[model samples]
Each structure stands twice: as C-alpha cells, then as structure tokens.
Target: MGNDGHIAHLTGPRRPRALSPLREHLRDTFWFAPTAGLLGAVLLWWAASAVDLEIVALLQRERAYGAVRELMSIAEDAKTIVTTISAAMMTFIGVVFSISLVAVQMAGGQLTPRVVRIFVRSRITKITLTVFLATFLFSLLVLTSYESESSAREVTSVPVVQSLMTLALVGLSLVLFIAYVSSTLRLMQVGPVVDRIARETLRMLARQAPGSEDGGDGAGVRAPETGWMAHEGRAGVVRDVHVARLVRVARRQGVVLRLIPRIGDFVMPGTPVLAVHGGTPPRRALLRYTVSVGVERTFHQDLGLGLRQLSDIALRALSPAVNDPTTAVQCLDRVVQILAAVVHRPLGTVHHRDRRGAVRLTQRVPGWADLVDLGLTEVRAASVHSPQVTRRLLAGIDDLLLLAPEERREPLVRHRELLLQAVEQAVPEAADRRFASHPDRQGIG
Candidate 1:
C-alpha cells in the first residue's frame, strides 16, 4: 500500500493536470528567465526611446527653453550614469550569482545534492537575475539613443524618458540584489532548507484527494491481466502521470489501465509500464504521452520526494565525517511533522472511474507505513552511536505514536523498538544507554 492513502475511487476526469515536460524543463533551468529579461529590456528601451523623442519634439515646437535646458542637463547626467550602469551591471550579475552558486555547491555537499533543486526553483533568485540582466541591457540601449552632436548650450534632443527608465531599472535591481542575497544566505542554513522542504511536502499532501475507506483494491473491482505495454525509451524515473488524459483514453477504449511503476520509480528499457485490463491496450505512444519520465525525481507528482530528500540530509548529517547530530535531529523534527500530517490521511492505490462509475485507471501510491519507514528507518539506523540523535529519534517516534491510528502505530512502534535495541547494542555504558533510551525533543537537552 502506498503511503499517500487507501484506494481512491475518483469519478469522472476532473483531476489536476500534471506539469508537461516543457514546463518542467523551463522551471528547472536558469537561462529562461535571463533570456526573457533580455527580450523585455529590448522592447522597453524601444518604447522609452520613442517617448523620449516625442517629448523632445514637443519641447522644441513649444520653444520651451527652460524645460529643454533642464531636460538636457538631466540627460547629460544620465549619460554618465547609464554608461557606468551598463559597464558595471554585467559584472554585478556575474559576481553575485557566481558567489551564490559556490555557496549552493558547498551547501549541497554538506547537506544533500537534492537541496540544489530548491535554489534552482526559487522565484526570488530567478527574478533577481532577470532584473539585473535587464537593467544592464536597458542601460546599454539607452546609451545608443544619446544625441552625440548636441552641445551643452544648444540642446536639440534628450533621451529623458529612456534615462529615467534606466534609473528605475537600476533601483529595482539593487532592491532585488539585497533580497536575493538574504534568500541565498537562508538557503545555506539547515533550518530554513529543512523547513522549505517540509512545507513543500505538506503542500503536496494537502493537494492529494481523499481516498475511500473500502480497503479492497480498486474498491472491489479486479484489474484485468490481459495485455501490457513496455517502455521503449531510455531509462528514466517516472516523474508524473497525466491521469486525466489516461482516463479519457481508457474510457474511450473501454479498457482499464494500471501503471506498473509508482511515481519516482526508475524504469529501464523493456520495463512494463502499463497493464491493460478489460480490453486491448491503448497504443504505446498514447501511454508514453500520459506518463512523463525524466532522469531524476521531482515533487510534481511524487509525494515521497520531499521525505526522501529530508532523509538524505539526515543520513548525511549523521555520517562520521560530518557527525552533525543537531542537523540530524532537525531533519528528524521535520520527518515527524511530515508523518504526523500523513497519519490521518487516507493513502493507497487510487482508482479513477469514468462518469459511468467504472474504474478506468488505477495507481498505487505510497502508504502510511511506507512513509513512516521512508522518513525514519534509515535515520534511526545511522543514529546508533549518537545519543543526541537517539534521544531525538525516540521522541519523534513517541510523538507520532500519539497521533497515529492503531493500524498505523505498528510502524512507529516497530521503529521505536529497533531504535532502543540499536542503542543498547552500540552504547555499552549503562548511563549512556539510559540517556539514549529516554526521549528528549531537544536530544541532549
């Protein structure tokens, strides 16, 4: 049974659409935002230059010597300022992001490689980079519109509007730079990174549709075992399934399709990706479109990914070389929080039915026990030597047991016993064993 909930029988095809490959790609890349910013900078410069020309022409026709003189002086000052901005903006972007990346790399090495994904997906980081690049490009374009022939006394035309726009961009970039630096600094810290991951995981949990209580698989309907479709492409992790489209295709074909691998599972070539029950299997191409595969796992549809990342951090922290028990305890705190949220939620196989109430698509999601194990088991094993971690692990398990239902308490109980036994075997001193045995939320404290 999947940890997400019991078998869900969802009627009709009203499920949320999964993120398409192109969108997912765009989300993960750094180039898209800067590229868009560059394009926007070009368009903005053109508009500002046009407006500046119009203002200059009006000033000349009206013979407004006072306004023209003032504007030309502003333009003269702006020329020097914009020139400096254009020259320095690129360097600012390179230096800021370069340092940020190095910090990110160090953080990744210290915690887990998966944390880098958080940095990549940060909106502030992307927006900051975009504005910085756009400011640079806009300033450069504004410089081109400067009137080289105009002397200080006889001002013909001034790039007044363009210069103002350039100044505005520069100010915006400065504000974003400060914000970006603060955000990056927080990302490097253990508390903020773990909190971010836990929050994202809980959001995914909240989005999950409630599952039915009828514990039977497919709500008493049996999946057909007639035909199957094998994956044909290069091996990749199952990122997301376009369930709405799959159900539509299944309903049309008068068949029930069961996905063989759960989300986050890697599929090698020739792996059976879909099982066709009730009728002929749909074309391989159709199945391929509905199931998105990638080289790595994403949080898009994989509910366990957040927990997996948290576990990785905990294990890394507990390693002898790092031996940061407090970091491990922090991770355990989040793990318990995630499990507490999952305890009451229904999780298991999900059944998607057509409008007629027939189960057309079925998927196995992570179960409650699976989640408890994923979040705690590995961390417990690695915490044997650290009394601080052991105490925290016991406290976390005890906390979960208080919230977990009877059926769900088994995993928590089992983990508690295993934790005690491991602590006993590893810590030979009775006083230390007693210390490790006692549950403490703060570990040592």
Candidate 2:
C-alpha cells in the first residue's frame, strides 16, 4: 500500500457498543473477586449458625444431645454475634479488594498474560487456604454462639448480600480482563506486520515512477519502450533518490545505512541502505502478484511503461560516452524535455460521435508520420543549438541505449510503433475513421 492508504486503514472508524451496569461493575471488580468470595462464605456460615436449634434440627449432633440442643438455643439467642462477625468479614473483604485494585491502577495496569496466568494458577492455592480458614472460623463461631446465649439477637443482611454481589461482579471482571489482554497483544503483533509490508510496497511503487528520468552518459536519446533490461532492481522514487544522494553526495540526508567508508573507498547500492531481508515470504508474494500487478496494469503499462522503456533505451545509448554522473543526469534532463514536447502534442484526434459522448484523444493524427519527422528535426536542431541541454539529454539516453548496439535503430522504430499502437487503443475511433478514409495509410509518411 501507499503511505496514504496505510494511514487510512490503521485509523479507520469508531465502533459502537451497548451500555449495561453489569458490564460496568464487572470491569471495576478485578481485585474484588477473591475477597467477595471469602466474605460470602463467612456470612453464610454465620447466618446458619445464628439460627435456632429447633429451626435447624432437634438434636443436630451425637452423644451430647442435651448439650448440643442447649448450645444451639444459645446461638439463636445471640444473633448479634453472628451479625457482627459477618459484617467484619464483609468489611475486611472490601478493604483488601479495594487496596489491591488501587495498587493495580497505580501501577498503570500493564499486567502481562504470563503474570495473569500465574495469578489464576495461584488462585487454587489461595482458595484452598481460604476454605480451611472459613471452616475453622465457622466451628469457632458455632462454639461462641452456643456459649453466649441469652444476649440479644441482631437482624442484619446487608453484608451477606453485598458480598454475594461482589463475588459475581469480580468473577465476570477477571474473565473480561483476560479476553482484553489477549486481544490487545494480538493486535499489537498484527499492526507491525501490516505497517512493514505496506511501507515496503509503497517504496516499490515509488521506485517504478512513470514520468521520472535516470540520466546516464552521452549519446542520442531513445524512447523507454526500446527493450532495455531491468538491472538495478526496484525501489521507491524518493528512496532511490535519497539513496543516491546519501551514498554519492555527502550523507546530508541521513539515509540510515550503517557502513562507513574510507576517503577513497568505493560505495555500492546494496550496502545496507537498499537491501531488506527476511520479510515474510507469503506477504511478499501476495504484494508482488496482486498489488504490483495493479500498479503495472493500470498505471505503468497504460501510461508510464512506454515512457520508462524509452528512457531506458535512451540511457543505454549514452552511458558509454558520458563519464560524469552530473553530465549523464543533464543528458536525461534534455531527453525528457524533448519527450515532454511530444507528450503535450495530441497523440490522437478527438471527435464527438454523439453530443452526449465524452471527448477523448485518438491515434489518427491525420499526418502522424510527418508530425514525428518534424519533431525529430526540431529536437535535432535544438540539441545542436544548446550543447548543455543536448549533453544532458544524451546522458539519459546513454543509460538505456546499451541493449544492442547494432539493433538500436530497429528497436527504436519498434518502440515508437508500440507507442502508436497504445495511442490507437487509447482512441480507436480516430484510427478506424482514418483507416476507412485511407485504407492503406501508405503514402502519408
């Protein structure tokens, strides 16, 4: 993807949700779960102990039936003790849970998955200890309630109810928290994969620029479609230019390649800055076939490919003659100027088939052969008049003109024919009309 497309994907749109108090409570109860559970157990034991013996079982024990009955009666009488112990359990649970929660919040809630798993595992040990403690407390409470009969029985249920509610809330919260942590980690992994591939693809597209030129050495300029082979590999246009400047020019751009050079040491392209390694092969394959195909088929092949071909041919033609990179760059500039002139000229004629039809360029320029001859003559004269411009134009041409020395002219003609064909496809009506008017189209040139 391009830079714009990547940014758009990452920061897409907001999502909607439904509000609920249960969900809100669960979210807030990360630390309260264990505490609530313990408190609830304690309160349940107290309530059962505080009830009358006649209300539970007549002789709810063994050989000490009289004693047990009497103790049970006393426990029922002292309901205040049961209520007080239950309230204390609830308060203890609440304070401990609150403190744990506050500590977590203060630590910025950056608990890792491993840490959470450890806590969950430790819960088993914690639960075992709490159960033992609850059993002992229950036994002690029963004994005390039996001994303390004749005191007033207090009626209270707020602690028991609150503790039960807390248990439910905390359980739900932990489940949600685990899910959130898992999802967040997954997203973090996915984000970098997307970004890396996207940036790399964008760089490739930029390197495959349509209108850009790479000037070489002195020679007559040719067009881009002259069958020049790709050698330097591909990179983004901006990145390529930046690499060139950083390596060849002084390192003013901070291109980020780590290799340092001696005063006279030679520099190379793949010396770290241009090379990327160990990318996920599948992602690379997908991008190569799908994304690159779109760029070439839609943009490069239709609009830019022909131009690039011509530029390559022109560069090869001039490379051997020009020694200095600056001179070569100048040569490419001149050729681009010449090509620019032809680009502006209508490659085809536009006519309205119907009033409602859109106007478009057509390939049948009436006297296309004559126009091309005139263009060549004009550029040749201009080249002679302006030596610096000519040199630059020739330099760009030389970079691409080295494919086959003897077959240069033939390839050049073929390249122009391809452009003409492309222009015809771009505007078929003009071509059809021209063919109908002059079927042979033989004497025009």
Best by TM-score: 1
- Superposed Cα deviation of residue 353, candidate 1 (Å): 4.2
Model 2: lDDT to the true structure: 0.31
Q: 1-445, model 1: which lDDT tens digit per residue?
A: 1221222444555444344555766888889998999999999988888787778778777877778778888888879999999999898888997899899999999999999999998999999999998998888888888776664346545888888898999889989988998999999999999999999888666555554445543443465577888877789999877766777788888888888888899999899888888888777666657777888887776889999999999999999899899999999899989988878877787676666666777777888878888998899899999989999999888898898888888988999999999888888999989988999999998
TM-score of each: 0.89, 0.19
What TM value does model 1 have? 0.89
- Report backbone clashes per prediction: 13, 40
Model 1 regions lying over 4 Å from their true place: 1-25, 60-70, 150-157, 211-223, 353-358
lDDT string for model 2 (283-353, tens) is: 22211211111101111112222223223323332344532233223223433433433332322221111
lDDT of each: 0.83, 0.31
